[model samples]
Target: MMEISSAFASGFQGFQRASDAVTEATVNINQQAAQSSNQRALETPVESRTGPSMEQSLVTLGSEQINAEANLKSVKTADEMLGSIIDLRV
Candidate 1:
């Protein structure tokens, strides 16, 4: 009977050790997961919201392009007129 009791005590100790090991492993895994989540949050950029509307930006760009094209046409017309005047003089 004494030997049986000793064996039971040893078995209980082994079980307790296994439980403690499982608890330690769980804690380590939770810590690693939390750290990885924090690292990812820090590495990513926050969403941007403040900027010009897409339509408005496109309209401004189109206006500038039209103004530039008109200026180029006027310069070409002036150059042709000057060339014609030079030809007449010649």
Candidate 2:
């Protein structure tokens, strides 16, 4: 029984770590995408009128922000759940 509980705790901890890694990767990807879009807009010829518009970029940024927030919330919730489980065990 003790070994089982220990294994469960380790599993939860591993899950939490994985969640953190995923969240970090997501945020990095979003930042890179925004940067790439902005860079393209700047590099494009003004007369050509090509590349992502400011409005579109803003919308994308907003969505990415929301996504990052959601991921953060997930991490927090997972931490809370792990804590609750430990409390119950004790």
Candidate 3:
């Protein structure tokens, strides 16, 4: 059905976005960590950094992981519904 197909597309897109977001947040965290270590090694003053804090990035990662899970579930539900429809028709 159109609804099921749409659900499939929506879920897939949502999952992709969440995955990208998680990846971005992870990269940001890693970059910040690397900068910190490098700074400490050099014994230089902490450079002014402008961006989401580590805590915020961690939160984003956590929330995006949850979103990815929910989107995967939605895709699975849509697939199951499609399968049930085919089973009924056949």
Best by TM-score: 3
Query: Can you write out model 2's per-residue Cα lDDT over 1-90, one digit (the tens) per residue?
Result: 455455556655655655565555556556657666887889953343345455555555566556556655555665666778789999
Candidate 3, residue 86: CA error in Å? 0.1
Model 3 steric clash pairs = none
For candidate 1, the C-alpha RMSD (Å) to the true structure equals 40.1
Ranking by lDDT: 3, 2, 1
Global lDDT scores for all candidate models = 0.53, 0.59, 0.96
The TM-score between candidate 2 and the true structure equals 0.48
Q: Write the per-residue lDDT of candidate 3 for residues 2-49, one digit (tens) a residue.
A: 999999999999999999999999999999999999999999999888
Model 1: per-residue Cα lDDT over 1-90, one tens digit each: 344445445545544554554455455555555655776889864443244444444554455455545545554555666677678999
Off by over 4 Å in 1: 44-90
Candidate 2 regions off by >4 Å?
44-90
Best by lDDT: 3
Candidate 2, residue 32: how far the Cα is off, in Å: 0.3
Error of 2 at 4 (Å): 0.7
Clashes in model 2: which pairs? none
